[model samples]
Target: MRAELFDPRTEAVPAEWDKFLRDEGAPAAWDAGALAAVAWTSLRTVLLGVVADGGQAVALFCGDFGSPRRRNPVYSPVGGPGRPGVYFSRILMGFDEGFLFATHLDHAGRVAARRAFERALKARLGRRCLGVVYQNVSAAALPVMRTAARLCRPVSPNTVLVNRWQSMEEYFAGLPRDRRRRLRRTYADVDADSGLRVGAGVPAVDPVEAARLEQLTRLKHLSPGEVLVPLPSLYFERLNHRDGVRYFVHTDPATGALLSFDLSFEHAAGLVTTVTGSAAGAATGRGLYWDLYLREIEYAIERGVPRLEFGKGLVELKARFGCVTVPQYAVAAPL
Candidate 1:
């Protein structure tokens, strides 16, 4: 097997890269265009492609090389704080869920591909490279990952709500009595506020306001001393026009003020909620946050989406809202 690296920002990724993802039933996050969107804005992003005999593309891995200017949780805390000239490569850059596979390969073949990719990564990033980190790895892929890296630990669980009910009313009826009562109260409060309305689909959002709200929500959840690179307003503006991405927005009707927004990626497999934020000084305790989850659930149910992935964080809280926690792991190997 041979491994080759391509900078999606400058090089045109081979068509086979995305074909392999589709044939293997990969998620929307693995889409070449989506990855390129992120890569264009990131400091350094690379795609690792593995090919077997006869030049058959066996695997494609995407990630970003850590930069001191932008410290991301995926790579920073895993190998210590970010420092100038100290770098690590983190696979699965754009999304925080799912695992990779060397498609159409057996155990031994898969292991070899993993090893080749690692070798290429080390060669690409020399002595300054601290390690290669794989984040949000699922259980089934752990064994293969362990073959190349000894460091592995459980991170946050990815929350998913498997839709079973036929409709929103059916879903509400099925919830526990206490939860049902609280949900009803929340709905009533939201309904009474004629000024606030929840709508789906991408709207012409003000990039500046949207970025501001997203940063506020992001900072509120980060652990102390942890640093994250903030996505610029331009990124949001570009995503607004991208297909397969939509926003569930809460806005004040009369004033046309954006209150809160939840962004989700629509895929054949399911709906994955991505970034979420609320305007600063927005009224709290009115169930606005909870409404986002409920609206996402309703949207999924309406579309017959099998699952609604809420991503990581707030494990217990998400569980109470009928989401199941899927354990996620991170593996780090020093170069």
Candidate 2:
């Protein structure tokens, strides 16, 4: 088996690309159409391809070799071990690294396919790129990366809430006593704050306002001395209307000022909170972050979805909301 590369933007996108992803139980973000739509806006060198055997495509992979500075750390021109940049495969929507081989492949086949894909990728751009970095890799994909990538390490751990409860109270009851009290107190405080108004769906914000919102979100999330890759205001506009996505915006009731926004993606099973941002000032009262988290749970219970995905970090707070933690990792190799 060998890896064959194709450009989804330039070549005829195969019908099987979507079908393969679906069959593998891939998330909505991994859908070829969605990735193709937004992939180009940030990445310059994109690699979309499949693992083929006897001319039949059996597995698929898509990635890019570029420094998405805003979303990632700064890098040097020649990237590698101790180098600046990286060859990355970022899964869109979900904001994870993108890497999916056919789940049906037996152990040996899976290993071979990974090796071939890496070999082919290296031949194409490995010489000039830093190294391959596959972010947020799932446990099932770990074995294949054993031989394909060199260093493997866990990054932030993910936390999720399986939406099996019938009511918001039932959901809250699952948390420990301390957590339950904390959430109730926080929720009550936010509810009593007259200046705050939290609502689901996109708020009425013009392009300039949207840009400011994105900037605020980036600044709030940035670490010390980190450079943020600026997401275009248009990206937010497009995401606000994307199918299966729900936007929860927090505002000041009196002045209609945008306080915070939560963007989550919906699927057959449940919803995953993808993007979030808030003004630093909102940190003081009404607990904008907790408010958004509570709103998500309330929304989930009302809708009766089976799960709510809260990506990595805020373990203690998310745990208080009854979100179970799931580990997330990155697999990389020195080119």
- What are the lDDT figures for the candidates, one per model? 0.69, 0.68
Instruction: State residue 91's C-alpha deviation in candidate 1, in Å.
Output: 6.6
Q: Write the residue-wise lDDT of candidate 1 on 64-99 in tens digits.
A: 675544444333221334432333333333346323
Candidate 2 off by > 4 Å:
1-28, 31-85, 92-97, 101-113, 189-195, 201-211, 252-257
Angstrom error at residue 212, model 1 = 2.1
Across residues 251-314, which tens digit of lDDT does each residue of candidate 2 receive?
A: 7899887788777777676787876767767754557778788888888888887888888777
True-structure lDDT of candidate 2? 0.68
Query: Which residue pairs in candidate 1 have backbone atoms (N, alpha carbon, C) closer than 3 angstroms, thus clashing?
Result: none
Error of 1 at 41 (Å): 6.2
